[model samples]
Target: MTSAIGEPNAIAITFFLVFIVLSLGITVWASRKTRTAEHFYTAGKSVTAFQNGLALAGDYMSAASFLGIAGLVALSGFDGLIYSIGWLVGWPIVMFLIAEPLRNLGRYTFADVLAARLRQTPIRIAAAIGSLAVIAFYLIAQMVGAGNLIRLLFGLPYEAAVVIVGAVMLAYVLFGGMIATTWVQIIKAVLLLGGATLLALMVLSRFDFNPLALFAQASDMYGASVLSPGRQVSDPIDAVSLGLALMLGTAGLPHILMRFYTVPDARTARTSVGYATAFIGFFYLLTFVLGFGAMVLIGRDAITGIDAGGNMAAPLLAEAVGGTPFLGFISAVAFATILAVVAGLTLSGAATLSHDLWVSVVRGAKADQREQLVVARAATVLLAAVSILLGIAFKGQNVAYMVGLAFAIAASANFPALVLSIFWKRLTTAGAQSSMIVGTVSALLLIYLSPTIQVDILHNSGAWFPLRNPGIVSIPLSFVVAIGVSLLWPVASEARRFAELERQLHLGVESADELT
Candidate 1:
């Protein structure tokens, strides 16, 4: 997929530098406006619904979506489309179940909503840990993708590329916080959609603007099996498990959930979700065109000859169809995708670290905005270092698979507690904490025992856990653990407030905001 591996594409590298310079320019502009913790965390809650929608879509569609899914579809056909379907299906659930209530309830972070009535310290600790776990896995995945893609496009060293990504993301989050991050995401989203539109058009024009013709050509070249489900999800249980994680995980992603608070009100939050759903769903559909186009137009042998993972398919397709100039544009868009996503993830980690753990938990909410802002930037730097190290360590791994694991963990650790705390009258502080702890531990343990970590990473043939995804087990267990623990010893104070929380969940800011 990467024909110019050792040979640097000067045009692509030039465009890459251009995008980086422009993005850093955004950071500088945003820093002028970023002042308090509110600005740092939620962009002063000034983002309009449509803008936040674009930012949400941008932050959500990372290198994993653009490159990883396209490559998967290029290589595995119908099986790769499953990832797109699963990823997009989650948006509606997030809109109906999470967006409005989450925005109204949480001022900055989702942990605020989860810990609203519960004991702040315990809930914050548990929620912080859960948020951090998701961010850690996701950051590494994006960083790994960044490293590989940069090396492929620019001929840069993998470790150096990862560090460059880390450093740039840190600068964005540290100085401009959510404001810079949001603009970066919005810009990236626009560029990605635009670039993908052009690429898809170029691919479709070759087949007389007929998708079926493209598929027919692909079938002629690859065979009928290429249009059918393949080895990626041979196990029905694994498929269901993965679907569960993707559908539920959107409710839990810290960065995505945090976007809700970027808007002004619950109604705006709802509006943002609608816009985001449309944009994200549209983007997912275009990926099919890009993926199938790569297969039929670029050919499998050429793709695999360059990068066996097929990650180079889209960029290579750009080069084949549009020459080095278009290749440069697409490469820049992919890099922008990685930069925007990693910056969003890093910001979420900072919010979780500083706002939830440091201010709310450690300082008992007495820490001022200035102090919190300081901590947030410090945390961003710390997270950046961690991301670089992990990205280097996880080089050559499948970015798509790593993202799937991240979704599973998010679905398990954060989704259940957030849902129950909002809707269940019987939910107690102990229940939420225990559920998060058990969900996180069980998910990590299952992954370590599963083929993903054991056989894939450790090269051990005998993995204790058969399925690569632990969501089907871990998600339900989280709900059960919460229920069981709450029933065993309910926190009457927290349980009693469920009536008000429930009222707020249904109403707009009047009820929900006042409940806090």
Candidate 2:
């Protein structure tokens, strides 16, 4: 499965290039249709319900979910299912609580929703900061993953792989905008599902098409413990921390939230989540088949030798079952998976800077469509540069946990603000601002003091914060702060405004202009 020293994988390279070229072509086509802030940020709000659902699934299911979770399953066995379950739980909550209100109230970003009822200035600033921070962490992790996966798949150097990812993703966002980004996600999701499905069938055919037989074989080879729990996480507190993060994180993810705006209305937004939930839940189940298949068929030694973290389990499984050709196809799908996700993240970050910060804050209501478009493109360039740099800086890092850190931050910072804005009425502008700022700062601070940082980065014997995931404490802490601030320092006018937001939330009434 390993390549000769520094040699290129021509099969993988050819497939990778083909996917990139095709995605760029889609970008060119989308660029012709892209105009105004609406087109750039929300794809002109014209995406159909089912299409937006597929795009949502594509955007939400990153390389971490595809490669990292399967690798985790291959490595930790039953404990890996915890990660899958935790991630899937968040979608139901999104479908029920957040998606509809977000679509009804917001035009572009989550900031649109929050700033709908509150004072625009502080809400925009706080939300913009939270969005950028989430995007920074999430984007860097995906870019780092892009570097590693490409290096392994196509034999590119880490820097070159990262740069290629950065350059291409920037094009998708800069020119084609949300239109190009949404299509790229849909294409990648289909390829990933197809590749995963075929790989699963190949594995299952070896054992009479019964998944239990595959598990039985894994249990026999690796011991019954592999089919049981408590391997990677034995501590209840730490497990809860990770669970809370995964369960609540999706509702807060800006790129995922931004997808709702691409669809026409609140009803469509809810329908898209229903579709995404089905697609994502099915994909996660397939990962179990793929991961267990890797365990029984490929064996631990070979899988570890390829990747210590087992991130290559899925691709290598394709190689094992269908040989080099299938391996090349699956690897290219992984590359596309990374590219589509980072494009979505970069677009969200650009919106934070251009839509929220530049047009809304700096230029105020007077900002023209042309100026907003120019700033968004400029922000994309700036974000792409930063993403490339961070990707290089964190070379060889475990991208799954890097993504987990992102989820923890999202759960802590963005979730509370968004949920409270929509659900709780007495939330003041100052209260929302403090909750966001506090939640963001607390998550980052606790993460730095956490064992993941203390032992891994700081080389310390003991961590100031014992948990790797901060959500057990941070998520509740954020809700408490937001609610506490709102009740204690009630703004009478904002509370009066709550009746209007309630109308939009319950009746699907369109929100009035943000700046007005």
Which candidate leads in lDDT? 1
Off by over 4 Å in 1: 510-516
Positional deviation of residue 495's Cα in model 2 after best superposition, in angstroms: 0.2
lDDT of 2 by residue, 125-165 (tens): 99888888888889888998989888877777889999999
- Candidate 1 Cα deviation (angstroms), residue 137: 0.6
lDDT of 1 by residue, 89-177 (tens): 89999987788778767877898987776888899999988999999889888998899888878888998999888888888989988
CA deviation > 4 Å runs, candidate 2 = 1-7, 510-516
The lDDT for every candidate, in the order shown, is 0.88, 0.87
User: Candidate 1, which ten residues in sequence have the lowest lDDT sum?
Assistant: 507-516
User: Candidate 1 overall Cα lDDT vs. reference?
Assistant: 0.88
TM-score of 1: 0.97
- Clashing pairs for predicted structure model 1, backbone only: 1-307
